[model samples]
Target: MYCETDDELVELVERARKYTEDGKVADYIPALGRAEKCDLSIALYYTDGRCFKAGDVDKLFTLQSVSKVLALALAIMDNGEEEVFRKVGMEPTGDPFNSIAKLESQVPAKPLNPMINAGALVVSNMIEGRSTHDKLGRFLTLIHDLTNNTSIDVDHEVSDSEFETAHLNRALCYYMKQHGLITGDVEDLIDLYTRQCAIKVSCLDLARIGMVLANKGRDPETNRMIIPEGIATLVKTFMVTCGMYNASGEFAIRVGIPAKSGVSGGIIGLVPPSMGIGVYGPALNEKGNSIAGVKLLEMLSQRYELSIF
Candidate 1:
């Protein structure tokens, strides 16, 4: 109900699209580097099953860091909150998401929060599975249920590309392993983490997932409980606190939505009790967020008074 027509959203998208020129795609990940820097799209899904979209909504992108939120939820469900938090702290870091400074400086040497690569690796390690394939299957099952799209799966190209460049992530895993924070083969853990990040989702798929979270883990259309209400709340809290890397506070002030962003230029946003938003803009700011996507969300938030704050 927030946005009455697709044209309204299209106008917003066109306005935000201008900022794409000010950013650049994430070239660090070779596969991700291939994304069109000027492309931007958005989809909004409501509890009533209404959806509004603009731009290339069918364009798929890897989840990248955004997968951390889903992995953390599953990890918490597999292992209790106490067990997961014992290995990873709930604090946000001012340093870059991939920075290793805090890991060395902290006394216990655990990653600050699950949104960062280090913490996400620990959470990925906690996924209950007999093997790497089994673990990824379980994670995919969750995604399938959330989006009602069984075809959703990892982009192996992106997975392999990320795995190839995951040297820093390997270091973080080894460091956490040394601190007794995570157990198991570092390489296997990296494989699972990288695959998890490589999961592909289109804007509509992302919006559907966000809609479930906004509805407190229930699929309004199917009337089924996809995730526990408490778990969804916890995940949303993390999205508010640490979802946008170091720019979370600024995003909160500007957009005021519980959301998660990825280096692949995807963002999943929640307008609690009603709507879920998905945005994709490959052009990234220095902080690894979708620059134009963030701007679009800010405009949508202000125009619709969508801030949960």
Candidate 2:
């Protein structure tokens, strides 16, 4: 067995802790700037009914871009794939998650994929609701359902920080609106997207959510479907293609699991129908994923034979 006990997993996490020192904590968002830079943790929940946890598993952190997956899923449910596709493309941009060049030069100015900020903002706009608050409530509800944790809440300070520093995303939203790719109020959509990104969770919460995806969007423990099959497939495809910012391709080859990485130093990866692994290491590499997290997942995937490939 790869990590027979929590202690073994803790040892592996400690061994990889050095990688976190190689990266920097996200400072762009002032609230996220408040997180401990050296925080490191891992949590795993297997569909076969095994669980392992190590390190700062109880520390709460903002979801950051990871919330894009849930927002994309809900958007697809509200509007079919084609309609959502109009606002966001399926192709990976291979650029920075917040790259403005892709938005300015791309056809239709549709965001390359929902995993990126532009695409996520576009998708967030399409969430069917009367107002930004309503849409955010629904998005949080979906996350809660998937994790079966009702206490999940947005950190308003983080949301406020992101909202204040969201110039690029705001510009992207305006560009999208001008191109007619996104309808309704641009600021409203941006606010909703920012709020979604600020939602907080721990490694344990993330592992549980990953477990849902691992089981094809079903709550493996509850035996309930949390997401439609079609939407789950779409989300998983996007995760494989664009989850790890610009390093998604490299990660897919090396780590080989459907995964999503957030700038907050959270990475959620899962082997289909098998296991979900969540890692939190606040230091970020050049590609914006947690450095220690990437290394740990690469090793764990190999050791556990958890790669989809």
Candidate 3:
């Protein structure tokens, strides 16, 4: 859907910036910790190629956990859904995104959903790559194809920084291996996950990819299927239920759209049959969501009746 007024959207972005000061930029990883906490941006792309952007639309950021969505899609495409689902379950854990508490207690020991670190590691390892670099190339190619932007690539420094501090991720991978949920080299899978998480993109890049999902997996310009409709639907449902860390259900209630959020403070919201929206505010709340971005989405959803419900 076309925005009612570009000025209105711009004004909303300005208002949302105030909340950014209350948030904390991620600091666990050295590279991500360097982001300016107040930086904020948003871009919205319609199916017809029209676009509306506000704030720092060109500011670059790593995809972080937002990469999980695409990695899961690629895995499902390489292997059928049944085979992939056998490796990961389709439910929310209600625990932290990286928590292994559930895995310790659950019987199957599969990740609750592909949005979490554990699940993403599993899918990244399944990307049909003979080597880690090849898997990265495949993931990059998928992002370029979906966004129609060939310039996007991984932020190698960020990936390297993440790899250095990925002790917890390494532990999760090993645990999965011991449970037979994952059957690969733990080091290789962690490398794949870390690199994918460090893939570089701006708000505009994310909006285009979201537009493809909004259009039911078909490229609006070429009418070519990027993914099967059923697959897109499955991924979107995961976004609604578990995309955000622990705040997913609250986000769904407030914004009422399918969405995924990254610790880098990027969020991709899919408004079916209309627009794909991308937001980046490098200031996260307690649940690892962009404090300002979520506020902006909530306001926009209310102002335009953008909620699917």
Best by lDDT: 1
Q: Look at candidate 2 and give me any clashing residue pairs.
A: none
Question: For each candidate, C-alpha RMSD in Å?
Answer: 0.8, 1.2, 1.0
Would you estimate the TM-scores of all the predictions?
A: 0.99, 0.97, 0.98
User: Under the 3 Å rule for N, CA and C atoms, how many clashes does model 1 have?
Assistant: 0
Per residue, candidate 2 scores C-alpha lDDT tens digits across 102-221 of 887876667788888888888888888998888888988998898778999999999988888999888888887888877887778778888898899999888888888878888877
> Per-residue lDDT of 1-309 in model 3, one digit per residue for the tens?
458556877888999999999999999999999998988888989998898899988799999999989988889999989999998889887899989887788777888888888888887777898898898899999898899989998899999999999999998889989988787788888888888999999999889999999899999999999988988888888899898878888888899999999999999998998699999998999889999999999988988888888
Weakest 10 consecutive residues of candidate 3 by summed lDDT: 1-10
**Model 1 C-alpha lDDT per residue in residues 217-305, reported as the tens digit of each score:** 99998999988899999999999999999999999999999999999999999999989899999999999999999999999999999
Backbone clashes, candidate 2: 0
Relative to the true structure, candidate 1 reaches a TM of 0.99
Error of 3 at 113 (Å): 1.1
Candidate 3 stretches with Cα past 4 Å from truth are none
Please report, in order, the local distance difference test score of every candidate based on alpha carbons. 0.93, 0.86, 0.89
Q: Is candidate 1 or candidate 3 better by lDDT?
A: 1
